[model samples]
Target: MITEFQLLDAPAVPTVVVKRAEVAATHLPELFDATFARFHAAIAEGVVAPSGPPFGLYLRMEDTLDIEIGFPGVLQSPDENLVASELPAGRIASAQYWGSFDGLPLAWAEFVSHVAGQGLSVAGPCWESYVTMPEPNMDPTTIRTDLFCAVS
Candidate 1:
């Protein structure tokens, strides 16, 4: 997939998140599903309205990955396990990926390379904006994810 490079002035996003450290790749789907369900439940209870697509905010990616999976919205009385947080706003490099989530690593790799090609440096943890929800029978090609990396 072709990775497009662009700059974004992202605003602070109020979010409800499920944080996990050293998460296994195989467990991601379930974690995301559970997190979304909880967030959706909050919405069902009239806690908050959805303001943006679901996102995976990566805090670390070394021997283990530390991340948060959640939805952005206006703050509400979150449940015990959910915490309200803000996505920092600043200059970033981004690209839209039109394919399965499985292809994300490749897209990110290209996006990073593209950023470097432009003489920019990554300054913070990367995040993925899940633009399209995937269904079991859905075509993988139809999925869309917007990737972002804070840059200096």
Candidate 2:
């Protein structure tokens, strides 16, 4: 996997999410699909226009996975089930992964190594922005996900 490292002045993005802890790898697909469906429904109902692609904000990744899955938005949702949160603004090391989600760990490993090699340390939770939505006949290689981990 090819990775790129850059400094970003990211802005805080509001989002509606479903927070989950210790999520099993097998359950992620279903979890994300259901969560995003609810999010899109809210978007359609005029809650907010999606500011960006869907993302999974990783709060914890060791021992157990903790994450919030949802869409970035301009307005907070009135639906109480969808928790409103923000993606913090800061410097980040990022990479674009062009394949299935299963290959993500490799991409992340390379990204983290690059960050450390540059004498930078992770400063916060990492997130994956799904830049391209999956389609029924879409090729896995064509899928795009941009991964980011805050660094300082």
What's the CA error at residue 100 for candidate 2, in Å? Answer: 1.2
Evaluated against the true structure, the overall lDDT of model 1 is 0.84
List clash counts for every candidate, in order.
0, 0
Candidate 1 lDDT, tens digit per residue, 62-147?
A: 76789988878765665777778778788878888999988888888888888898899889989999999999899999998998
Model 1 residue 135 distance off true place after TM-score fit, in angstroms = 1.9
Clashing pairs in 2: none
Off by over 4 Å in 1: none
lDDT tens digits, residue span 2-117, model 2: 45557788877788677999997778889888888887788888876777888999999877789998878755446766777888887877878888888988988888888898
Mark the regions of model 2 whose C-alpha exceeds 4 Å error after superposition. Answer: none
lDDT of 2: 0.84
